[model samples]
Target: MRSNGGPVIRADIYVRISQDLTGEEQGVARQEESCRQLAADLGMEVRHVWTDNDLSATKKNVVRPDFEAMLASKPEAIICWHTDRLIRVTKDLEKVIELGVNVHAVMAGHLDLSTPAGRAVARTVTAWATYEGEQKAERQKLANQQAAQQGRPYTAGIRPFGYGDDHMTLIADEAAAIVEGAQMILAGESLTAVARKWDEAKLQSPRSKVTGAKGWTLRGVKKVLTSPRYAGMSTYYGEVIGEAQWPPILDPEVHYSVLAILNSPERFSGGKRTGRTPGTLLAGIGGCGYDGCTDTVNGRGYRGVPVYGCKDTHTRTPRSIADDRASKATLARLMFPDFLGQILETQNAQEGQSGAQLQSQAKELRERLDGLAMAYAEGAISLSQMTAGSQAIQKKLETIESELVSTAGIPPLDPVKGVAGLIEGWPTLPLPTRRAWVDFCCIVTLNPAKGRHLTSMSVDDHITIEWRDVSD
Candidate 1:
């Protein structure tokens, strides 16, 4: 059937299902079938079928790729399973009107864009849909608040690393790992180091609920380490509102220590490094180098000149023998040409050996395990001994190989190229990014000049620089 003054009208079929947990087409297929039937009854030829499965209509900034493409296809009209599925919000309703495309909902009937009354009716239906979505969200928020107040564990989001599916009981092995990770962090190991160790051991990182990605990341380690959940507390809107029902994997003291370091002002040095004097190159790592001074040194300017002096001595009424010239000379000496390149090389070596070397070790362990099985069959070893040996070997092999599948698609970046990129982009990079780079690459310590006169010390006598691979 043709519209007045037009040829046979062609329409696109749109179907949506709020969720398809199994990633199957059961819901959307039924919706599409009904929509196709509606198009047949209306005498409109279906030019294309578009679907947005497992996508919510009310989700903000959600990209419905197929729906957008269908609109661009510019069919004479769209036939949806329902008006709510077509446009749940006013922004989307306005877009349909702006496009001048008519809509026909199988449940709600025709929405003609050519007239004001039809547009008003369409907007009213969409407004109701939006209101319904808001009400449901508010109810959910209230329910979560009630659950928190009652000390019931929040059973949503990706399960924490050490917890089982129930979200309260601990998984013994994973729990042990979490406890050990906390101890390591408390013992001066950096978050980057801890995450690298986990990746090397092939520990299974928590899979993302939304993206389905599975792998250990430094940021992920920091989150797991710093979360109040491990401290037996419940947080709502990022505040500790109450104690949780679940047991904690970390001791209270150790948990707090990790948080202190992770939240330290130096690690979070924004536009400039705080707690250190400005315009000082070694502000984050500057220290007193005097043999007997035994006091903390900091970057400060003396007589319009930059220097490192003991905090107490520099603020002294007469200022004893704290040397500014010796500190600057020390800093210059530590700035070796190969310093950054060496750090980059070390980083490359660490992330590089994690792949093939670990794989080879795993392969060797598997072969040894198979040999032990044969030895048992040949009466070379007792059954109990064979079982013990096999268990240990299998565990070792599993640890080494667990991450190979997940990392197969990742390509290694060259350290030289990384350094080159940093150099080229240094001028334009944000201050925080640049500060992060400095903190991760090296640790500088300055000591007061001793034995010889304090004023006579050279750069080598006062400064010590240690390269490191920590990000924070």
Candidate 2:
């Protein structure tokens, strides 16, 4: 095959494409074919072919395994479809030049690495390629920002869980699951439990379809629950921008409540009782009523009998009796028309500082945060000042979000005649749901008996139930 050389030069073909949208590697395939033809025309024997499909060469941190291997092989020459495909930055160009081998680009002609003029040309071409990549990145960033501000659905990433491929049309089954999962989380079900339930139901996450992951992870389930997209909102850089064009899987109030609960500092900071599925009905909801004691009462065996006892051993009550009383009290409150009316009235009156207002305040605070960051970037403020200012704004945002969770109120009950069906089915309800109902209606506390041994004391004398006010 050699026309002018005594020994044919060995050449390796390298191909790369930034994005393979179809995941078909067609671009890299085409480039490899062109490179092979170029090698034939140059009278070089193609020894190896290296491809980095769907990988960007402009990013400094991205590692191209095949490219590295081609360089290490020390081929007499390298062939590529284009200079941009082979290298997009000066740093990569320098690495190629260090090999002291000729480069033959089908589109850009030959580059003799052994000559100073050829090295300069390679550097110049790489610099231009880097400039083009940066300009393209800036244009894409602007387009995404505009799309978010206009409340358009992002079509780039994998399809969201509750939506169809378009990310706008809702899939009824998936949407219903999302709603149910949100309610379960709000009713004190653990994230792990919800994830297990979904996995058991054969629900697949977005990644499962691509990676063949068999089941959902706790983190995946949490992301679905807290995503603003499910609430029909568009987000840019983690800040909600506007209402999305897609229909919402969850009501905004419920979405905000889930966000607040999951993001609560107390949930992460020593609040062990929150967001856990209780082993017993009154395990975490009941507290000790002894003077100067503020500890939760847990369900455990006392003398082989199930009882709710203080963590510090200050007081204990029969679990059966306490649970019965609390359930009865909650059902009674729900059954009373006047009590239900009072709750509705109180909720209505609090619309002045409702979820919408809190969202607005949150948006304002987020803007202030952006401004603070910009100021720091421009050297208008010191790091300490920026930190202090951001901290204060963040605290206010947390308080508003916490208030949003409280205003979400009790989960809706089944619409049955006279509300009797709910009371009848109360015994068959899940423990977490029942516990949430109890928490909504009253606070149960166990106190030491006035003058009797703890074991001999009647539950009625030792347990105190304080009904929550309608406003609370």
lDDT of each: 0.66, 0.79
Worst 10 residues of 2 by lDDT: 265-274
Q: Tell me, by lDDT, which candidate is best.
A: 2
Off by over 4 Å in 2: 269-399, 402-472
Q: How accurate is candidate 1 locally (lDDT)?
A: 0.66
For model 1 the TM-score comes to 0.53
Ten consecutive residues with minimal summed lDDT in candidate 1? 314-323
Clashes of 1: 6
Model 1 lDDT at residue 375:
99
- TM-score for all models, in order of appearance: 0.53, 0.58
Per-residue lDDT, model 1, residue 287, is 50
